[model samples]
Each structure stands twice: as structure tokens, then as C-alpha cells.
Target: MPTGRALEDARSMLLETGRRILAAEGTGGLTSRSVTDRAGVAKGVLHRHFADFDAYLAALVTDDAARIRSIEPRSAGSTVDAVTDVVEQVFTPTTRALVALVISRDEVRRRVRSPGSYGIPLLMDATAVVMDVLAAGREVGWIRRDADVAALALALIGSAHLLYAGELGAFPDHSATHEVVESILVGSL
Candidate 1:
């Protein structure tokens, strides 16, 4: 049996591989062979750490999601710099990757069923943080107060999904979406 340190090393390598594959390519590039190749580890290493690609991906998604969730919720500043900071910092690469996985039927199902950190509670927790951010923004008079929090959250998630979609990825619609969200919140307030 490998020592704890050895196991951690292997897991780290696998995670690195997963992140690289997903970032440079996309979900399609994630495979045992690809991960092992990228990680420079033996195929057995992956099998030891994960049941299969589905299992490995689920764990990866969870690990990365957790890291991203570390970004604390705060009032979004209106300045371009402030908004950019939240976007780039809070929505870190891992968060984007996790969101990509969430919108995918296959990935989300695997994550839900998998025995890992990316469970329903985790998803809901992340959603709650986002909802809170929106609510706080509205309460502070930065967003329209009357905005339907639930629907706004849904719209935000949808916009994130649509932004990452293949064909329609090029539509400069986030500004519009943001405006709508802010408008709704401000209007409600």
C-alpha cells in the first residue's frame, strides 16, 4: 500500500492532468490515457485514484469547484476594475470549468451520483452564495431591488452557460445580461 504522501502525490498529478486537459482542450479531451499522458504517471495510478473516467472527472470537478468557491462573496463594485476583479477572481478557471460541467447532463449526473464533494449540497451552496451577492447588490442600491432573485439567478447561470456554448459563444450579450440583472434589482428596490 502506498503511503499517504504517495497517494497525495498521485492524486495531485491526476488533478493537474485533468485541469490541463479541460483548460487547453475541453471535456472531450479528458480520458485516462490523456490524463496519464499529461500527468506523466502510469495508467495504474489513475485507476488507483479513480474508478474510471466518470469517477475521475467527478472528483476533478468537485475539487476545482471547491477551490473556486473559496472566493468570498462581496458587494460587486461598479467600476470596471472592481467588476473585473470579481469576475476574474471569483469566477476563477475552476469555477468556469465547474459551471461547464454543471450544464452538461453527463457531467452533472456523474457529479450528483458520485461519492465526492461535488454533491447537491455543494451545488446549492454555491448557488446560494451567488444569490446572496445579487441580493446584496440590490439591497445596496447597485441593482434593481424588485428583481426576482430566483429568476435572476437562473438567468445569470443561463448566461454563463450560453457564454461557453460552442456556436453562440461570440455574441456580446453579457453586458446586456448584466444590465438586465442590475435593472431588475434597481427597479425592484
Candidate 2:
């Protein structure tokens, strides 16, 4: 039990370290030694927490996803409010990594192909909020009665990626981002 707990604790620490490295030094700074140094753990401790570097990176992404979810407000009143919450939450390290993953052509291919990446609940929670809000909107007749809620949820999530995806290509200005999100919500409603 002690060993298992330690491994779990180390995994959490490494993920936290990964976020700090990304913020402080960008993606290139995410070395195992850096993670150990940031985590204040010995090198082998990081290794013991995961199979290898790829495992660590994947875990970092997962951890950031959780961090993103933590910032999502429970009952945002409006679609714009929801969008604001998402944008603010994603500005964090995990959100940056997620944006990075989708923007980079190579990482995009890998993430889209790998279903496991979405297995983390953090990303899913964002989607869940969309669903929840839409469901509430439906109850109040603020959304379409015959709407495809899941599809709308997916669309909202996709728009978030487009607005926040700094890695894919140069994005338009804030007006573009706001218009895109508002357009999606309007379409659904």
C-alpha cells in the first residue's frame, strides 16, 4: 500500500513539475531530470512513477486536463460566461499543452489517432459542462427543442480548440474567437 501510494504521489508531483517546466521554459524544458528537479524528487523516483519519458509526457497532459477542469464553474449563467470560464481555465499549463498538442501537426495526428488521450476526465468535464448547460438551456427553452446535444457539445469543444490552439497556426484576433464561440452557441439555440 505504501509503495502504491508513493507511486501515485510521485505521479502527481511529476505532472505538477511538467506544468511548471512548460510555463517556465516551454516544451523543450520537459526533461526527466528537470521534472525530478522541479518535483524535488530524485531521478529514479520519476522513472519509478512511469515506464519512461513518453509515459511521463502523457501523464503531464492528463494532469493538465485535470487542472483545466478544476477551473470550470459549476453553473455558469450564460454561454458567454461558459466560454469565458473555459478560456480562463485553459490559459493554465495543461490548457497550453492541450492547445500545443492540437496545434502542432505531428502532435495533432498522434492525439486525434489516440483515443486514450481523451480518456482523461479533465477534457471530458469541459464537454460535460457544455452538455449540462445545454440541457439546462433546453429546460428553459433557451436552446433548440430538437437539438443534438452531444453533437453540439462536441462542436463547442472543437471551437474551444480552434480559439485556443496556438500550435496549429496563427489565429485571428479576439473578435474571431468570440464570434466563433457565440456563433456555435447561437446555432445550437
Model 1 ranges off by over 4 Å: 1-8, 73-75, 78-110, 113-126, 144-146, 167-189
lDDT of candidate model 1 versus the reference = 0.57
Query: Candidate 1, TM-score vs. the true structure?
Result: 0.67
- Residue 100's C-alpha lDDT in candidate 1? 61
| Residue-wise C-alpha lDDT for candidate 2, range 109-130, written one tens digit per residue | 3533346545324445566666
**lDDT score of residue 107 within candidate 2:** 43
Q: Which window of ten consecutive residues has the lowest lDDT sum in model 2? A: 105-114
Q: Who wins the lDDT comparison?
A: 2
RMSD of every prediction: 5.3, 5.8
lDDT of each: 0.57, 0.63
Superposition error at 72 for model 2 (Å): 4.2
Predicted structure 2, TM vs. truth: 0.67
